[model samples]
Target: MIEKINLNNILFLDIETVPEEENFLSLDDDMKQLWEQKTQYQRCDEFTPEDFYDRAGIWAEFGKIVCISVGYFVNKGDIRNFRVTSFFGEEKKILKDFSNLLENHFNQAQHVLCGHNAKEFDIPFIARRMIINQIAIPNKLNLFGKKPWEIPHLDTLELWKFGDYKHFTSLKLLTKILGIPSPKGDIDGSQVAHVYYVEKDIDRIVIYCEKDVIAVAQIFLRLRREELLIEDEIIHV
Candidate 1:
């Protein structure tokens, strides 16, 4: 299905996010109440909202993006390289920069965005964060009334799903089953909030996020029945 899409025209991305506040107690009264309600069904009676706060990053309303790593394929004569770059810091700043990149460089009709589970997670998370930060949604991300086919987002997870919609697959599992090197050797998504909030290691998260981007690209190639990219071909920016 994706054989017709040019690899150079695709922008591969992944993001790392953390709770809006460093801790649950830092939330205002109303927000704290809201968070409790938000996680009610997911948390058991044994767990308090404060204990569950570590997972706040999963929800856009209670979380903020800390890093967004983007990678793209480039060619220079006989050389082919995959370059990855990250925009990170305060949530609003990263959102603004990412939105600008989308609006300026990747807004063309022929461009497609690919990431694992991006359609359900990353893409919408960025759009919602943009709105909350008062940043204008870029043309590519402004999905208000567009038809399903009009959306240019490509999700590796969805592509892997084929027609069955009841199951969920993690990127790590897919890589393992497909023989793609794991991107999450150091840490996984569940630890991101802790790493950012406790360790203050945004760089680590950025590296981890970039690894996911590379893995996503490899997964795409696997879908296309192409060979996987070798380690020497990746370039970080």
Candidate 2:
């Protein structure tokens, strides 16, 4: 049944994001209140352009994405053929180009978007940036408002939940639990912004993103196999 879902009809993606620059923050009082309450990070004491810039700098210097990697896996008989591509450039340009590529390559109505923690971070981040850029948001990404189980979205983190909501798990930790080789070397997510800012090396960022994509693919394979084994055992028993 899983195989019948057409693996080619899925797009696996990941994104990196940074905070808005000080000049970028022209938030009204209401907007500032909402943002301070809703944002994942801490809020500033005052709402000045300088404070906003410092906030953005904090993200640019640490919290934001430096690269986004996308992977497509299509089942070819016994083999799962995968193609991994990375978009690394100025954040605005990369987001624009990447959005265009997705629109051109896949049919929004047909393909299921897949990612690890994408629903929470990647999708929203991309969508917000697209709005800021005045780019059309893809229909698939527009499903963010839908309930988790209602949407066609497949977050590996959510899938790992099975039936119970017990604990929150990171992708790296999940890889270890599933015996999947850790693709992240000594580099972790926290260091990504620094690497991109200080080294100004797009290649390193690309490599880091590519490794994450590979890690995601490996995790998907392991989960699929585990599910198959469980199904087969149930059938026999």
Candidate 3:
């Protein structure tokens, strides 16, 4: 079934996010209380809400997307190329630009969205943020009322699970085990918030995000028993 789907019809992507505010103290009194309540179970007397604030980016209500990087396949005859691009800047603009890309170019019923663990994280995060910013959700990301088989989304992490519901794998670990090149640089997801807030290095984050997109596409290729993408085949546009 995986080989039946045309690679060109899929848009592979990854996103980077950071907390809405730089620190706990920056939140208003009401939000502060809300944050505490939100994490009460997870914190469990081991750490205060402030200590757990760095992970706020994991939740749409308390964080904002900083970058969304996407890559799609372009196959012509014997040649195959993957074109990659990114949308970053103000959260609203990022969501708007990404939404437009989906609505305009990838709006076909056959078009699908692919990401690592995206079914649980990336897809919902984008939809939630778009709603918060009052942007209409793109057809590709809008899963409302769609039957399970009718949904046009694929998750590499879920694929790797292979019916093992308890199994979990990180992109980095999966890539290593599958022999795909590692995407990690000097920074990782844990450091993205600090890079965006303190170092003010969005460019670095964009590069990281793009790398993840490429890695995802490569992972799909591997899953289909195809060759991994050579560096020369990856184009950053």
Candidate 4:
């Protein structure tokens, strides 16, 4: 199946998000209540809503996208280029820009959206965030009427599973086993909120997001038993 799909037609991507507010104390009464209720299932008895606030970025309702980095393959005769681009800033602006990119570039029958566990995380998160930002869903994201098989999403994690629903794999772990260089070095998903809130470093986050995007594509290539692209082959757009 991997060999049959055109790598050039897929948009490989990843996202970075943070809590809507830097601190729980910054949330209004209504938001506070909503967040507390939302985390009830996972929140431990000892931790208050404020204690769990740092994880808000994982939930679309309590979080906002800080960065969205995407890459796509372009075949040019003897050379192959994978161009990566990023959208970062205020959530509304990021969402709007990403939506426009999809609508203009990848909104076609031949284009498939691919990422590591994107179907469960990135895709739904982007769709929900776009809705919250009051932006119209792009053709690629508007999955309301599409049949199960009609959806064009291709998840590297899902592909790795090979129909084993009980198995789950992280991008980092998969890349390590596949002999691909680790996209994550010192920082990780858990530190994103702290980096954005405390360090105020969106650029760092964007770099990390782009690495994940590249890692996702590399993982897909690995699944097809193809050689991963070297750094020079990756172009930043």
Q: How would you encode candidate 2's per-residue C-alpha lDDT over 1-237 as one tens digit per residue?
A: 344556677777776544442233455566555555544345345454334433452322223445778877655676545777877776667777777777788756567777888777777777776776677886667775777656666778877877466757898898889987676865666555456555666677677667676667667767677321121111100
Residue pairs with backbone overlap in model 2: 16-65, 17-64, 17-65, 18-64, 22-53
RMSD of each: 1.2, 7.7, 0.7, 1.0
Tens-digit lDDT track of model 3 for 1-237? 889899999999999999999999999999999999999999999999999999999999999999999999999989999999999999999999999999999999999999999999999999999999999998888888999998899999999999898999999999999999999888999999999999999999999999999999989999999999998998889
Worst 10 residues of 4 by lDDT: 38-47
The local distance difference test score of each candidate is: 0.91, 0.63, 0.95, 0.91
List TM-score per model, in order.
0.97, 0.73, 0.99, 0.97
TM-score of 3: 0.99
Clash pairs of candidate 1? Answer: none
lDDT of 1 at 63: 92
The sequence of per-residue lDDT tens digits that candidate 4 reaches over residues 1-237 is 779898889999899988989999999999999999988889869789999999999999998899999999998787988999999988899888988888888888989999998999999999999888889998888889899999989999898998999999999999999999999956899999999889988889999999999999899888898889999999998
Best by TM-score, which number? 3
Tens digit per residue, CA lDDT, model 1, 1-237:
699888889999998888999999999999999999989999969789999998899899999999999999896786779989999998889999998888888989998898998988999999999999999989888888999999988999999999789978999999999999999868888898888888988888988999999999999989999888888889887
Q: Score candidate 2 by TM-score against the native.
A: 0.73
> In lDDT terms, which candidate is top?
3
Identify the runs in model 2 with alpha carbons over 4 angstroms from their true place: 1-4, 20-65, 144-150, 226-237
Model 1 segments beyond 4 Å from truth?
76-78
Ranked by lDDT, top first: 3, 4, 1, 2
